[model samples]
Target: MAHFTLKQLKYFVCVVESQSIAEASRQLHISQPSISVAIKGLEDVFNQQLLVRHHAQGVSISANGRRVYERAKELLRLSNELEQDSREEDELVAGTISIGCFESAAPLYMPRLVAGFKRLCPGVSIQLHDGEQHELMHGLHRGRFDLAFLYDLELESTIVKEALNAPHKPYALLPADHHLARQPFVTLAQLAREPMILLDAVPSKSYFVDIFTQAGLSPTIAYSSPSIEMVRCMVGQGLGFSVLVTRPRTSVTYDGQQLVQLDILDDMPDSALIMAYLRNNQPTRATRLFMDYCRTVELAAVTPLAASA
Candidate 1:
């Protein structure tokens, strides 16, 4: 016989999810004492501290509690699946999946992916949120996102990453008429002489700076923008050139100024675009289906002006 009942597991999971016993009790429509007893019973069964409670603040789940919570979620999922199987075995795939997308990639791929997924599975709906690398990973742990579309840069160990087919190689963004834009491939040393518009987003900023450092050159940064479009716009207006990984389909900025993409003659590292989710957590049916769909989708390659010639 199992030492703990589903009620105990539910209460414990709720406490971890809601981050407070009072909140869990209110959410579950159970009395505080009942929820507290259930939590204590779980700790007694496991013989480990499940939660570290704060007097005035909320509680934090211990390492052991996180493990238990993961397994409990799986158990609850299976149990729910079994119940659903009995009720509607032939039901169509349908659920709301929350996805966290990297801000830079969102504009490039999200619209197409969302539209295609909806067409393929009209029963399913996708809720998309865009954030930086760290924010996306944080949302994954907090159960706010089922999956995240992010680069392989600076990933957490707790995240299980599946690399997509997208190839994200850093390329130079220059005005269509820039003298260097005519070159088949430009080196960092050549571009370093010109003013640079840095993409000043967290990991992106560091990643771009490292490329110059590796090339034994430093750029004269004229401007920095958190917005990728802003960086592109600044470069398009001939303010300066910038290095970016994501290549939008069009080389034109929002203002219709044409920009040019050129391969870096100097060796530069490539970052893989990946789909990441919690390491041990089982994906929902909708999330699993979406992952499958993403694998077959072909990502657009970076288009260089020289290549088109």
Candidate 2:
């Protein structure tokens, strides 16, 4: 019998993360119908309904689908690393590594890391792919990414996790004219009165939820959106303030919009950026070198003064 191919595994993982054909297609740079066909082909091979579809609500994985997802992920990871492993060991210092990321780190950190890594390892190349938490995780598991920057995910037996840096102080991104903008930094308690923007229902989303829960108040949320830019734009437009893990990059205009900083009542959450890769997968020399770069980068300590830069 013809077995599943790596291409099929990738499509499965993408759909699982995106939960919709159209979204996955757009992300993978494939046509929607092609993504649909790949998924149906996998279902036929497994002889089970890997995905359960709801017309309006989108798609979700079935119990059986989860099992396939986990195993296919490991296999994909193995295949991705195999080529890297075979390259000349020292030559491994040269080549490219793919990363799965989010707006949380991409805006500010990536530039610094890339520049620092380039200076140190002149031959290395980096490719970054950005998405939300679920999408990032799915790409990591599917072996499409050599590594990723993710929140502290509860990892599985076949994956390795390394903590990089703690989450920055959570702050309210507000319109420059908002009342809270007048203060240098406001406390979490003061934020209670304002309507806010927050993330959706996911592990990382729940983490943010807990931050508010611990504060002993539910937010007056007037807006909820998945895209980081949308959330920032909404908050910048005076729609509402946002409690986000990442701080604003600098005092600059975004799409001709202005943003102000508001202080939080509490310290930032204890969340950290982690480097995740398959445990059993043997990364190439390039991947290993990249991993070392992630661990050792000397990020200048960011403070309110640093934030203004």
Q: 217-297, model 2: which lDDT tens digit per residue? A: 676778888766777778768787877666645534456566776667686566667778867566767777877887887
lDDT of model 1 at position 124: 76
Candidate 1 clashing pairs, residues 3+ apart or interchain = none
Question: Which one is best on TM-score?
Answer: 1
The clash count of every prediction, one per candidate, is: 0, 4
Estimate the overall C-alpha local distance difference test score of candidate 2: 0.72
Query: Which run of 10 residues does model 1 get worst, by summed lDDT?
Result: 300-309
- Compose the digit string of candidate 1's lDDT tens values, residues 1-309: 439988898788778877999999887799999998888988999999999999979899999999999888678656644553453467677766789998988988888888888888887778899988888887788666889999989887998899888867888989989999888889999999999999987689989999999878888999999899999999989999999888887877888788888889887888889998898666777788889999888986645443233
Worst 10 residues of 2 by lDDT: 300-309
In candidate 2, position 181 carries an lDDT of 83
* lDDT (CA) per prediction: 0.85, 0.72
Error of 1 at 97 (Å): 0.9
Measured on C-alpha atoms, candidate 1 has an lDDT of 0.85
Residue 99, candidate 1: Cα error in Å is 0.4
| Candidate 1 residue-pair clash tally | 0
